[model samples]
Target: MIDYQSGYILRPVNQVFIYFSLFCALMLNLLPIDNYSWVPDWLIICIVFWNIHQHRHVSVILAFGLGLLMDVHNSELLGLHGFSYSLVAYLAISWHRRILPLGLLTQALHLLPLFLMVSLFPVLTHWILSGEMYWSALSAALQALIEALLWPLATVILLAPQRRPIHVDHNRPI
Candidate 1:
């Protein structure tokens, strides 16, 4: 086993894992949730995971890239989601070292509000840019609530490290 003191280097395996995780996050973001979709912002959730675990390597740049990709894929205003995500990434990375040491459940709880703020900011921007806010505030509030409730479970699933195969020889050990 590699020492935990391995610092923050992104090994080749880690790079692959991070990029794969980002792709999965993008797909999840594209998945159509109904009008009252309970699903949270998957890309933000993924960003939080990466920020917590790999702060040194994956910073705001990755968040901006992912957000820009999302904007293109969804045909959103060029920098709407990108700007919001970049701010969130900056905040998450700022506290990452302190935050990651907390228990997973606690970390998720603390992160919930921050995620909501990030999501809501974009919605408000979209409203302003379009010159009319049509969505129901009550409904958005409810969705944010649901997202907060779902965060802990999602955090665990996202942050769980991939298990590597172990070699064993039954005959060698008397």
Candidate 2:
């Protein structure tokens, strides 16, 4: 087995895992959660997590593409989710270094405003276009709360593989 000077081995994250996780998140977003249609935004959560932790792997272009897919899936305005997700990607990338050292709860707190903005922008745009405020502040708050609560779990599950060191066989002939 390969030994590490730091006493911990870390496996390189594969591109396939990243894409697969994103796909899973998209599928989760499409799932119908009974009467609670306002389930926390799974796609956004996954995007935000990757943006902060694996910024190099997830880019603005990818975010835009995923957003467009989400828009098509949800039958909403074509660019709405795309714009929101790209904005989140930008914000997360900008603040990633600063947010990385903080505890999970702290990171979630830092992300609350971004989550709120994500939930609000479309509502505001729709309101302006339709001249009716169909948005509910309480619903937005609940969604943000749920997202924050799920952040830790997302990190643990999504990042767990990356945290474990790969076992290399030193005895194998190259």
- All predictions: root-mean-square deviation over Cα? 5.2, 4.3
User: Each prediction's Cα lDDT score?
Assistant: 0.69, 0.81
* Model 1 lDDT-worst window of ten: 1-10
Q: In model 2, what is the error at residue 62, expressed in angstroms? A: 1.0
Cα miss at 63, model 2 (Å)?
A: 0.9
Winning model by TM-score = 2
lDDT (0-100) at residue 135 of candidate 2? 49
- Per-residue accuracy of model 1 over 21-102 as CA lDDT, tens digit each: 8788888888776545366677787787677666776789878988898788768789877888888899888877767656
Error of 2 at 94 (Å): 0.6
Candidate 1, residue 97: CA error in Å? 2.4
- Model 1, residue 28: C-alpha shift (Å): 1.3
